[model samples]
Each structure stands twice: as structure tokens, then as C-alpha cells.
Target: MIVETSPENFQVWVHSSRALSLEEKRMWLERMRSDPAAHPKNRWGRCPGFRNTKEKHRSPTGRFPLARLIWIDWDSQADIPLLVPESKPSLLSHPSRRGSVCHPADPCRYHFKKDNESTTDFAYALSLARRGFSDDQIRQRILSERTDWSNHKGEKESKTTSIAPSVVSNR
Candidate 1:
């Protein structure tokens, strides 16, 4: 769930090519090729999807970087994880143990995975939501989902108690 809050300078750098030099253009392309959030194709799509440099280097596998996993829960999720494709991230001042669940603004190096056996990224969780899996099923797959993050901090719904929203919703 990449909520791009790119500053004006970054926006200009991304949308306008006239102000950049040849070297700058090369570097920007390299950056975009390596990073998906800034990649125009990813931004062009309606759903949040995996973006990385895998398509631009290491033999240029013929797949669009934006063609990866799709995450459409960006609008509703209380928190969305952010992953930077850069080799060296800058926002690691306070890294969270939950790698993929980092604050979207805080840059973190998230190793995105496709398998369901071990990997647990919010995007993958959103994928499960898109696939029609129940919230409990997702919770079983990812324990961090225990908190009802959709509600306010003080109004959080607890799953263990009788006041759990799932039970309430059932009623």
C-alpha cells in the first residue's frame, strides 16, 4: 500500500523531463527501474502493486514492474507498509521488528515474497482480502492482524474478548 506523499521537487523530477540533464535522466531512470513506487507504470494503475528493479536489471525479465501483486485496500486500511527499492534506505532511525508493517513514510528495506507459507507483508494480506478470505483466516495467517487497526487507537476492537467486532458483526 504505497501512499506516495512525494514532495513537490520529487513530483517535478518524476513528471517533467525538461529540467533534468542527461546524467540526471540516466540516474533517475536507474532509480525508477530499481524502485517501483516512483515508477510511472505503478503510479498509473488504480491498485497498489509490487514494484522493484527486478525487471530493469539482472537480464531484464520481460515483465512490467507494476504487473506484480495488486493491493486495493489502500483507501481503507488504517496503516499501509512502505518499502523502498533503493539499495540504501534513509528512514531507518527507528526500525520496527515487523519489517513489512513499517509506517509507510519510514523507509525500510522489505524483502517482498510471493509464497504464503512464511512471508507476511500487508500487501500480501490485502491480496488475501481481495481473494475473499475471511478476516479470521487472514488473522490466522498473520497474527499482527489481531489489532483492529481500522478503528481509532482508543476504540480498537479486541479479538480475544466478548466485545470482539467479529462476534458483534456476527450478531
Candidate 2:
């Protein structure tokens, strides 16, 4: 479903974007204001007709909206709302799909502990969470994934049974 519309709107956007330069944006804004459909929006991504390209907003290039053009200020170094826009790549990038079937939930620890892991490792978990899966549901989803754990070892050398511990400890 590759849809190509007027590049005119995109051109105006490219010109006025803060991601480029104030002088350039000003030049474009002034030049395009006269056009009837020159509204600061375009058909891109799952959304369309956005005035800005913030993660919450859409741009002429869809998810690849120019990083600088998003509504946030570059000086502030704000984070764009996380939106991968598509489910296929999202699902395909899962750790399980990549042959690592497990999302290790230690004896008991916060999931963020695995933040340093590959993005693929967190893909499924993140997907579940984003789709409104509860914390327990997300954990269950991870545990349900199949992975070859033959090469790895747990923290304890002793052969102990796996148990789901409450996240909050009494200590």
C-alpha cells in the first residue's frame, strides 16, 4: 500500500521545520501560507494532517519524521513519544523470534534491570505492555516464549526449583 500524494505539502514542511533552521522555516512558512491546502499537515504514517511532527504528531514521511522537526525543542533534548508504528517489525524483533526464547526474570527483580539488553529482548514484553497487558500478563508472555537456555546458567549454582516471587520484598 504505497501511497504517494503531493510532494508540495512535504516541501512546505521541509522548509518550515525547526529541525532545519529558523531562517529556513520562516522562509518556507511565509512562502507557503498563500496556498489553500497549505495547512501544516500531510498524509503520513497511521496519522495525517498533523501541525507538528512530534511522536504524538505525524509528518509527511510517517514514522521517520525528521528528528529535529518534532514539537519538542532541540535544546531541551526532550524524548519523542515512543511509537514504532508497525506491528510486524515489532513482533519479528522479539527475543524469542531471534532464537533467544527466554526473558530471564531473576529470582525476583525489576524488569528494567534488563534495560541494557538488546532491543529485541524487550520487543515482545514491550508490545504486550503497550497493548494493555497487565504487568503479570507481560511477565507471563515472556515466560511463555520458547528459548534455548542450554548455554546459560542462573545465579545460583544449586539446582533449585523456579518460583515466581512477589516483586516487593519484606526486607
Candidate 3:
């Protein structure tokens, strides 16, 4: 099922054969490019008739965008087993051992570099900012997706805020 919470923004839900664990759900959310901070089981989807109250989503005519159902498939089921990650990602990190997961023509360069995660996170945040993501969106992505940022609350907030100046100057 897919719900449009605002223009060009959607939340997707998959009905699977078995219930997924918290970590499993997190992985699925990451794969779907969802805000990981909102991936908790207790998180509720926008109600169909409610307005998306975010200031940026407000229409020019002084109204907010309405959240609505985009699509649904009650009869369809997600393949649960395919969603699970391999037990050892390091085995696949090496280019030769990547098999078919990481295409030979286009390999994922960010695969197993835990030591440089902070640098990578900063670069990722910069990319998002360059692509016109709002400050809040960049903050959420940094907090949720960056391993280094998650461990340092004060530092994370400040770092996200600092991205705005760089974004403006670069443009």
C-alpha cells in the first residue's frame, strides 16, 4: 500500500506473510529510503482525510495538502525471505566476492568503511542539501542513517545545522 502524505512524498507499507522484527523492519525502511527515525512499529501513517500540516507543504492559496491513499493491493504479499540481509556483509564487501549483488559495472563504493563513516555521512548530507532537501530532512537523514551521528546527539544537531551555510555558499 502507498499513501501520499504530501506532494511527491509517499509512505509505503508492505503486507508480508509473517511479522518482521524491529531490525528487519528497519532494513526494509532503509531499502525503501524511508526516514529511519519514523520506522518504529508504533509510528502511525497519515490519515487519508487529514491535512499535511508542514509549513512547506501548505498550498499557495492558504490551504495544506491533503493526505490521501495512492494505491493498495490487499491480495498481494511481499516475499519475506528476500528482505533479510546476509549474516556477513564483509564477505560481499570485496569486489571479487560481491557476486551479483554489487554489479561489476557499477559497484557501491561506500560498502565497508566503518572508520570513515563520519566523513561519508558529511558528504551524504552535503549531497542531500545540494539536491534541495530541507534542513529538517537533512537532519533526520543524518540522525537516522549516519552511525557516527547517532552516537553523538549534541554534535549531530550542530553538524546538521552547519550544512546550510555550505549549501548556500556552494550555490
Candidate 4:
């Protein structure tokens, strides 16, 4: 599915019966020339009909662009490509294993030290903010992903608001 999330910005999604593994998803995203900062876990796209309020998208008519569904190829039956096995490296050949805290049992070994739940949530919220999501929408998404935030009343709202300026400045 291809959605026009702004005047010219688009997001594409591939629906498949078989779920792609993390590596496979990353490979597919790369193949598709997606945003480099986009993570495989951030699967949701901008909601259609919502106004894209980025100043750059604002028209001379004093209105923002609305996100809309551009196209959908429902009949396409494409599948993710299969990856060939590469020669394995010995455990000793791994660089991080030398002194890092990551262990075989640590599921987060694939991520960097800066990629904790809070940081991930913030990044997700920031992405939404950049895409012109309303504060309520961003807050709802952050709270849904990080249920622990519900205990901290208003934190999600504050964070979502904070990201709006950052998103503007970033451009």
C-alpha cells in the first residue's frame, strides 16, 4: 500500500501472510529506499485525512496538506526475498564481545546502549511529530507502545508537545 502522507511525501507498506524476521525487514526497508532512520518496529503510517501541518507543506492559501491514500495494489502477490547463508565468524572474532555488557541471554544485544525503552518511545513520538500527527495522536501512540507511561500522568502529553518544536527546528 502507498499513502501520500503529505503533498509529496509517501509511505509504503507491504502486506504479507508470513511475517518477516527483523533482519529480513531491515533488508527490505533498505531495498525499498526507505528513510534510513526508520526502524522496523515502527510499522504504523500517517493517518489519512489528517492535516500535515509542517510549515514547509503549508500552501499560500494558508492551509496544510492532507495525508491521503494514493494507491494500493491489492492483487500483487510479492514476497520477501530469501537471504543466502554467509560464512559464520567465530565468537572470538566479534568485537563487542570483548568488553561489552551484552550476553547471549540479552535480547537487546542488537541495539545500542542509547536505545532504551524511553529513547525508543521518544524517537517514535518524534517521527510522528515530524509527520504532522496531532499531539493527541502522538500521545496515544506513545502510551499504547509504552504502557508504563500511563502511570506518569501527563508525561506523554508533555513529551509529545516538546517534540513539535524540535521537529520544526530540525527541518
Candidate 5:
């Protein structure tokens, strides 16, 4: 089973023991290409407010920089696995490690863990649109998703913390 999620909908496509025909593959690709979010131009659109000379040097790939993968057990008999598309020779190969399972309560339970250290390319782009940082500036401040920063004494913390409304009101 293969699952593809986008801003619009989440769909699961199942394959049996037989391999998909060339035409079938083409059809699936066509559907994906037709989606607005999946379109290469939309996926790589310029950030609203930032200017970065280095970002201009990036290759224009059709795939989004921050696209995430989630695994689910199609057979129900097997465990879900983590998938890294870049490391795989092809999409047909199965992942070696099983990823964290989807919790029953959360619909989107697969936590995305990026292999690289820098901020996700797409996320950096979004931050540029929202906060407007230069290429060098973005590069210097961006941290890996796994990075943990803390504050000592009365100094402000580097990380942004989300506070629930109820919790905030009680303070």
C-alpha cells in the first residue's frame, strides 16, 4: 500500500503481488502533477518577503523540499515502516526500519524526522515569507529539527513555545 498526502486530501493506493504497469504509473503521476500543491511551480514559488541569493542556486526539482512521509500497515499483518525516498534505489524497495506506529487517537500520527540537520528547505522558505531573512542569515540561524536549545537564568529562550489559552489565562 502507498499513501500520498497533500494539503487537500489523503489517499491510499494499494498494489497486489503484481507490478504496476507503465500506464498505471503514468496515470498516478499525472494525477499528482495535476494537483495544485504538487505542481512544481507552486511547490517552489518564491517566498513573499525574503531575498536570498543562494536559494536562487538550488535545482528546480518537482518534489517539495519539506514533503514528509508516513507509513501505515496496508496488510494489517505487518508493521509500519519509516521510508526515506532519497536513500532508496527505487520506490518499490521496502524500508529497513519500522517507524513509530500511528496512535489511535491522532489522525496524523507519523512524526516526521528529517535525516539532514539544517531546517527543512520548505520550512525555511516559509519562515522567509513570514519573517523575511536573507540567505546567509537564514543559514546561520536555522537549526536541525532535532536540536534542543535552552535558556539559563532570566534570559529569553531561543525556542518558541506554544501555550494553550487556558494555561495562559490561569497565569
Candidate 6:
């Protein structure tokens, strides 16, 4: 049921969506241009090459021509256009293997496996927040989690607390 399309074909896909109207498609494109969360800071780490601009031209491949128009309309302030390829032969048979198991309705699954590490970070942060952790605490936790603590021998040696504190402290 998942029909894949390139940036060139994005408009076609959007128009073909049974759930979305032409106005809705326009609105979604507008939101995507202004929203940093939608566009993201990292290109390759998130949805890559999606440009928000106002250029009313095609990429010679007919991909996302409307996106180019949007970019031009916005005065070219949005993210670059993403070049998503058509469904691969291998994936044609298994449509569900593209990303995580979470529903598209969930913010955590919005971009899916596009950025697995970032998604993990977001999920961890969300879990910590739900558990009553403050933003700073959650950030610290994620940063700590991402750090390679096992490789930092000096840090480990310094922080290790023992029942006989004096013995370990002296080392």
C-alpha cells in the first residue's frame, strides 16, 4: 500500500493521497517550509535535501515542482527538496520494512527510520519527560547516554566509588 516516489514525484503522490485535498496539500507544504522540526537542523540526519524556497521550476526530473514553487514563494528560506527514490525492487514485496513499528499518527514515528539515532534520542527524551524529568535533566541524560563512557578509562577510574572510599580515592 505504500507507494514510493521521488522528490520529483512528490506532488503526484500528494495529489494521489486519498485523505488529502488540494488545499491540505498546499497547507502541508507551507507548514513544512516554516517548521524547523519538520525540516530539521541536520540534512542527512533527518529528511535530507528538502529545500524551502520560492522557485517555480522543475528539477529536470518533474520531481517536487510544487516544492520548488513553494521555495520560490517563500523567498527560498526553507530546507532543500529531498530526493526520495521510487520503491526499490527488494522493498516492493515487503512494504512494512521501511521504518519503525510506531504509527504515523505518532510524532515519534513521523519521520520513522529516516534518522534512527535521532528518533531514539527523541524517544528517550520523551520517556524521560513523561517520567517527570526536566528538559535539562533529559538533555543531560541523552548526552550522557550518547557518550562512550566505557572508553573513557580515566573518567571511570575517577568516578568509581567504593565501600572503602579512601582506597579508591587514593588511586
Tell me the number of clashing residue pairs for each predicted model.
0, 2, 0, 0, 0, 19
Whole-model Cα lDDT per candidate? 0.37, 0.35, 0.66, 0.64, 0.34, 0.38
- Model 5, C-alpha of 95: deviation from truth (Å): 45
> How high is each candidate's TM-score?
0.17, 0.21, 0.46, 0.47, 0.18, 0.20
How are the candidates ranked when ordered by TM-score, highest leading?
4, 3, 2, 6, 5, 1
**Which should have the higher TM-score, number 1 or number 3?**
3
3 or 5: which has the higher TM-score? Answer: 3
lDDT of model 4 at residue 151? 45
Q: Write the per-residue lDDT of candidate 5 for residues 1-171, one digit (tens) a residue.
A: 333333333444443445555444445556556443443222343332233334433447633333223455555443223222335334535532222223233221013324432223333333332333444443344333324334231121122111112222343
27-73: candidate 6 lDDT, tens digit per residue: 56565673333332232221224543324543656544222222213
Question: Local error of candidate 1 at 11, Å?
Answer: 37
Please list the residue runs of candidate 5 whose C-alpha ends up more than 4 Å from where it truly belongs after superposition: 1-15, 31-67, 74-171
- lDDT: which candidate is best? 3
Q: Write the per-residue lDDT of candidate 4 for residues 39-118, one digit (tens) a residue.
A: 78866768778888889988999999889988888777566567654556556554431233333332221232234556
The TM-score, computed over Cα atoms with residue i paired to residue i, of candidate 5 is 0.18
- The regions of model 6 sitting more than 4 angstroms off are 1-115, 148-171
lDDT of 2 by residue, 1-171 (tens): 111122223331221222533343334545556444443344233223333434554554575333232232324432322332224334444334223334353322234344332332354444443334455655554444424335433331111111122111111
Q: Which of the predicted structures, 1 or 3, would earn the higher lDDT when compared with the native?
A: 3
What TM-score does model 2 achieve against the real structure?
A: 0.21
